[model samples]
Target: MLTISRTLSLPESELVERFLRADGPGGQHVNRTESAVELRFDVAHSPTLPEAVRERLLARRDRRLTDDGVLVIQGRRFLRPGAQSR
Candidate 1:
């Protein structure tokens, strides 16, 4: 389960995650490993979200929010093999 706040939590079943190969220039293993992550949350029909919160989230004008009320967040800043960490 994902805890959003003191009163809100989303079940694992309600969240969808996808891993993909990171884009852009990188080391040799970049194309071979799926280092990027995409997280999707369905706000329109989530049973855990309060109606007010759902409405507020959907009402926003964000590019990551789809017309179907699915919020998508992506992460791709993965450190390549043998690369030094900052």
Candidate 2:
């Protein structure tokens, strides 16, 4: 389960994750590693989300939303060797 807040939590089944190759530095090695994560969440028919929250999410004009009311999020992770933590 994914905890969004103190009173909100989403089940793991509602979230789908797909690993894909990321386009960035690392030359030839970049194509071999799947560092980019594509996350899909079905907001139209989720049992976890409340009706009001679902409606609000669907009402958004964000481009990440699809016609079927699915939210698509792309996560790109990049790590540099010998890089210091902020």
Q: How high is the CA lDDT of each candidate model?
A: 0.89, 0.89
Clash count in backbone of candidate 1? 0
Worst 10 residues of 1 by lDDT: 77-86
List residue ranges in candidate 1 displaced over 4 A. 84-86
Q: Write the per-residue lDDT of candidate 2 for residues 21-72, one digit (tens) a residue.
A: 8878755466898879999999999999999999999999989999999999
TM-score of each: 0.88, 0.85
C-alpha lDDT (0 to 100) for residue 73 of candidate 1? 95
lDDT by residue (1-86, candidate 1, tens digit) is 99888888899999999999889866777689888999999999898889999999999999999999999999987565667654
Cα displacement (angstroms), candidate 1, residue 5, comes to 0.9
In lDDT terms, how accurate is model 2?
0.89
